[model samples]
Target: MDLTLHVWRQKGPQDKGKLETYPAKNVSPDMSFLEMLDEVNDGLIKSGKDPIAFDHDCREGICGMCSQVINGRPHGKQEKTTVCQLHMRQYNDGDEIFIEPWRAKAFPIQKDLIVDRSSLDVIMQAGGYTSCHTGGVDDANAMLIPKPTADYAMDAAECIGCGACIAACPNSSAMLFTSAKVAQLAALPQGKPEARKRVLAMTQAILDEGFGNCTNHYECEAACPKGISVKFIAKLNREYLKTMIPTSTDA
Candidate 1:
């Protein structure tokens, strides 16, 4: 299959970028989207031109590093699929694919398809942890958590911090990603002690990093590669409200 790629190219964060066209000839339908880009890069190298730059690691889609907006959709149009997991076969021959870095104030473009997603790291650092001093691992059976709660926690923990939620949102909100991180721990007894502080700190960090607020657009949940639900965002809102409500001082 042959395709026309309009890829965003920028030398550095300060450099103004544009969508440069390149021909992807004889692209294999079986090739992963990154592999197709690899082939295009190889051709550029041979031609003494700069190759396209994109972030990718652990091509198995576990890393969530392959961040790209393909044809107006983050990680392409495939539901619940990351860019690394997307295959070239999804496109037809002679398709004109527009590839760009995630568009968000919080995720400034580094070069080509790479963006400074360290804002997410900053948010993670702000909270998303419990400082429990349990020295050794405890037996799984020791904790009497309901099975449903454990399952929900596991589901929330599947978030890979891909930042797709922000890219997909009209307001460029990080609420879904932040909420998932909070929910992963907040659902469990282990995360209860720090729950109040965790949600407050993380949500504040998101704002400090210049991320937009969630307006219930639902785009974040729709674009999440891990299928993390927006219900986590609601949970976060409730948790945040806990901190805002005044407590009784008199006994």
Candidate 2:
């Protein structure tokens, strides 16, 4: 298949970027989207031109580094699929594809399709882990966690932090991602001790990092490659509210 690609090109953070058109010739339907880009880049290098810049690692799609907005959709039109996992067969020959980086104030464009996603790291650092001492490792069944609770935690843990939620949100909110992180820990016994602190800190970090607020558009859930649910956002809200209530210990 042959396709025309209009890809964003930016030299640096300060440089104004624009879309540059290039022809992708003889692309195989079996080729992944990133692989197709690699072929195009190889061709460019052979012609003494700078290759297109994009982020990709572990082409198997676990890394979430292969972040790209295909046409107008993050990770293309495929549901729950990352760009690296997206195959060329999904597109037809003679298609005009628009490729761009994730757009969010917190995630400023570094160059071309790569954006600085360190803001996400900052959010995670705020309170994404359990710091309490557990004394020593215990038996796997020692905690006796309910099956439903374990399932909920596992669901939230599936978030790969791809920032697709932010990209798809009208407000560019990080609520989905932040909520998933918060919910994952909050659901488990190990996370209960820091639930209040975790929820407060992470949500505050979201605002501090310049991420927008969630207005419940549900676009984040739609864009998440891992199929992270918006229900986590509700769980986050509940956790946050609990922090505001006064307990006898507080008194």
Candidate 3:
């Protein structure tokens, strides 16, 4: 199969980028999207032309390092699939594929399809963890947690911090990503101690990063590679509201 790839090429963050067209010949149906790109890069290198720069580590979908917008969709419109997991068979021969990087003020383009997602790392540092001493694994009967609550926590924990949610949102909101971090811990017993602090710090960090606010568009949920739901956003809101209200335990 053959494909015409319209890929964004930029030398640096300050450099202007445009879609450069290249023909991908003899593409195998079984080749992963990144593998096809490797073939293209090899051809470019042999021709003494600059290769396309895109981010990819552990092309297994778990790392979420493959961040590119394919034909205007975050991960090519495949439900619960990352670009690394996207196969060539999903497209037809003689198709034109437009690929670009994540567009957002918070995720400025570094070069080609690679963006500086370290802003997300800063937000995570703000308070995405429970610092309590969880020394050694406890037995099943030691801390009895309801199965439903544990399931919810596990579902929220599926987020891989891919930034696809922000890329998909019209407003460039990071609420879904932030809320996933918040909801994952809020649903668990170990996370209750620093619940208010975690929510407050994370919410502030997102605003500081210049990400837009969420207004119920739900695009974040649609673009998430892990299929993390927008319900976590609601959970985050409730958590924030609780922080604002005084409780019996509050001094």
TM-score (all chains, Cα) for each model: 0.96, 0.98, 0.96
Write down the lDDT of every candidate, Cα atoms only. 0.93, 0.94, 0.94
Taking all chains together, the TM-score of candidate 1 against the true structure is: 0.96
Q: Write the per-residue lDDT of candidate 2 for residues 68-157, one digit (tens) a residue.
A: 999889999999999999999899999999999999999999999999999999999999999865688777887899999999999999
Summed backbone clashes in each candidate are 0, 0, 0
> Looking at model 1, which ten-residue stretch has the lowest summed lDDT?
242-251
Clashing pairs in 1: none
Clashing residue pairs in candidate 3 (N, C-alpha, C atoms within 3 angstroms): none
lDDT of 2 at 29: 99
Q: Write the per-residue lDDT of candidate 1 for residues 1-251, one digit (tens) a residue.
A: 99999999999999998989999999999999999999999999999999999999899989989999999989998999999899998999999999999999999998989999999999999997889676898887998999899999999999999999999999998999999989888999999888888998999998999999889999988888999999999899888888877657323
Please provide the root mean square deviation of candidate 3 (C-alpha atoms, Å). Answer: 1.3
Model 2: how far residue 170 lies from native, Å: 1.1
- TM-score, cand. 3 vs. native: 0.96
* Model 2 residue 171 CA deviation in Å: 0.8
* Displacement of the residue 213 alpha carbon in candidate 3, Å: 0.2
- Candidate 1 lDDT at 148 equals 97
